[model samples]
Target: MDSRDWGRFLLPYEQAVEELKVKFKTLRTEFKSRDEYTPIEFVTGRIKRISSILEKAKRLNVPMDKLETGIEDIAGIRIMCQFVQDIHRLSALIRARKDMVVVYEKDYITNNKESGYRSYHIIIEYPVQTSLGLKPVLAEIQMRTLAMNFWATIEHSLNYKFKEHLPSDIKVRLQNAAEAAYQLDQEMASIRDEIISAQQHFEDKTHLVSRVLNGIQDLYYYHRIREAAQFQLKFNELWETEDMWQLKELSQELQEALQRAKRSNS
Candidate 1:
């Protein structure tokens, strides 16, 4: 097809990728606000380039008119996780979503490829509303741990650089790197609870510190400069001491002061 035709055909796929990215990003934000354990670390998406799509179609023996049915990943989304378990958790979450229908799944993590690739791929048919009507676009969502993604990214670069005709030494090195990455994921998963607990604690402390600092800054605008300065001093002392209890007490105190300031002004 011509460039104009390709653009028209790809519009719905682009919309599907954007909508899915937003939906997953919103879920991550909601989980953060609720202080819940979110399975998603981050998300990214893209609609394949016209040239790449054409090449892929040619390689797969897909007809121009049959591209829509034959191509599963004209649009792609990648979700990266901190742990291997998160990949399975996110896959289940995607399956439970009502907005998209799961067309098929590939568990490469469990049944890894000969090239030592490990990931979970889900192909979903997402309905995109256009000016004309609803168009169902097929998009592939890949889930992987950070380690696996790192290895896959490097492997992809090597394959592209060598045009898939890698020297034996490089091929062996790539396989070794993949195994090391996989072992890293396994080690991290073994202590997943401890890692998650540490992360949650850090996030909580960060939130508390931000709230306290902002509250103190707001107090200065309310003409409570003296009180604000005093609280700032207390916060500095508590921060240096590394005392969690005092810091929480300071946050409560600052919060109550903010409420009083708002009430008196109202």
Candidate 2:
């Protein structure tokens, strides 16, 4: 394809990329706000290389129109997650979207490549409004955890650096690193319950502290310094108590004290 033809093919691909980015940004905001899962970390799109298109066309002796209409990977999206569980969660979210229909699905995580590459791939139909009206287009979505992505990225770089023929020693090293990544994933999964329990404990403690502090500040603002000071002194002593159970008991006592003060003022 000439430069002009290549530009024409890229225009739609670029537009589709922007549209998907906007979609993902809205989903991220929703997730932050407890609105939705939208478990997509990132989305990327690109037009196929002209040489690749030419080669495929030559190999199959297909017409330009047939190639463009049938091939879906001309536009792509990549979703990144922090944990492996997030991949399954996000894939379900994508499948549930009314605006997108799943055309294909591939789970490379379970069936990792010989090079130890792993990820989930999906093809979804996204509608983009054009001068002719709504045009349904195909886009690829890849989902993987941060570790998987890190491994794949390094592997890709190595593949490019070696021009698809990496030295056997380097290849072995890369495979070993990939195995390490797999082990890390397994370790994290095994500790998932303990990790979540600790996280919840911390969040609960944080929430309790915030509530107590805010109440104290309100008392100080309302000319109730005596009560506020009492709250501060009690909390300080609780901190020095060196026992979490004792701290909980003290916090409860302070909460009751604050409630009494509020009732008296009212």
Candidate 3:
């Protein structure tokens, strides 16, 4: 296809990728807004290059005229998670969505590739509106843990550098490296609960500290300079102790002080 034809053909696929990325990212934000543990850590999307499309189509024996139905990954979305389990959770959520139809799934995590590549691949048919009409575009969503993604990225680069023919020694090393990455994922999963607890504690303390500081600032805005100074001192003392209870008490004290200051000023 000519450049113009290629651009026109890929436009709907690009739109599908962008929309899927936004939808998955919004899931992460919505989960956090509810103070819940989100399966998705981050999302990324891309459209296959023109050269790549041609190469794959040639390899798959797909006619240029039949590229739309023959190419499943013209548009791709990648979602990364902190734990392996999160990959499954995210995939299940995607399967339940109405905007897209799930075509198939490849569970590479359980049945890893010989090259040691591990990820969950979900093929979906997404509807994108064009000037002509609504177009159904096939897109692939790859879900993996952070470690798996890191390993896969390096492996991809190496494969490209070697033109899919790495030296035997380097291939051995890459396999070993993949195993190490998988081990890291397993270790992290084992302590996932503990890690999550610590993270939640930090988040809670951060919000509490913010509320206390805002209260002090409100007091200063009310012309209660003395009260604000006192609040600052108390916060400093509690912060140094690193005691959550003391910080909580300080936050309450500042909130009540701010209310009193407002009443007195009125």
Candidate 4:
């Protein structure tokens, strides 16, 4: 295809990647707001470059005309998790999504590749609305633990540098590194509860601080400088003591105080 045709053809895939990224990021935010553990630590996405697409197409012997159906990974999303088990949780979440339909899945985590690569991949048919109409496109989602992604990233760079023909020593070293990464994930999983609890505590504190700040801002806007200063002083005390519960209670009290002030003024 010409450059113009290629750009036009890639528009839907680009849209799919951007939309999916936003959706998964929203999920993370929702979980944080609820102080719940999220299987997805973070999400990233991209559309395959034209050069990479052409190379893959050539390697796979895919005809240009058949590229749409033949290339399943033109648009890609990577979801990083804190534990191996979270990968399965994310997979289930993806399967249950109404916006995207899962056409196929590969459990590389359960069945690791010979090169020691591991991840869970799902191919989904996502529909994008355009000026013309709704266009259904194929996108790939890869889910893996943070360690697994770290290993895969290094391995991928090596593969590219060596043109997939790595020296024996380097190949062996990469395989060993992959195993070490897997073991690291296992160790993290063993202490998963502690890790999650720590994260939840942090999120709770952050949310409380945000609420307190917003309340203070509202008080200042209503010309309640004294009340706002008092609340700020209490906030500083609770923050210095690291008292999350007390801070939360203060937030609520401030809210009530502001409401009463509003009512009295009204």
Candidate 2: 10-residue stretch with minimal lDDT: 35-44
Residue ranges of candidate 2 with Cα displaced over 4 Å? 35-63, 196-266
| Global lDDT of model 1 | 0.92
Q: Give the winner by TM-score.
A: 1
lDDT value, candidate 4, whole model = 0.92
* Model 4 weakest 10-residue run by lDDT: 199-208
Q: For each predicted model, how many residue pairs clash, with residues at least 3 apart or on different chains? A: 0, 0, 0, 0
Question: What is candidate 4's lDDT per residue for 1-266, written digit by digit as tens?
Answer: 89999999999999999999999999989986786788888999999999999999999999999998999999999999989989988889889999999999999988999888999999999999988999999999999998999999998999989989999999889889989998999999999899888887887777779989999999998889999999999988888999877887999999998998898778
TM-score-based ranking: 1, 3, 4, 2
Task: Return the TM-score for candidate 4, rounded to 2 decimals.
Answer: 0.91
RMSD of 4: 2.0
Tell me which of candidates 1 and 4 scores higher on TM-score: 1
- Which of candidates 3 and 4 reaches a greater TM-score? 3
Q: Write the per-residue lDDT of candidate 2 for residues 1-266, one digit (tens) a residue.
A: 57997786666766776788778777877874673333555655556677766766777787887765666677777777756887888888889989779998989999998888889998888887777777777778888877898999999888878878989998889889888998898887789678666765776677667776777787776677987898888777766664567666756766677677678888
Error of 3 at 155 (Å): 0.9
Better of 1 and 2 by lDDT: 1
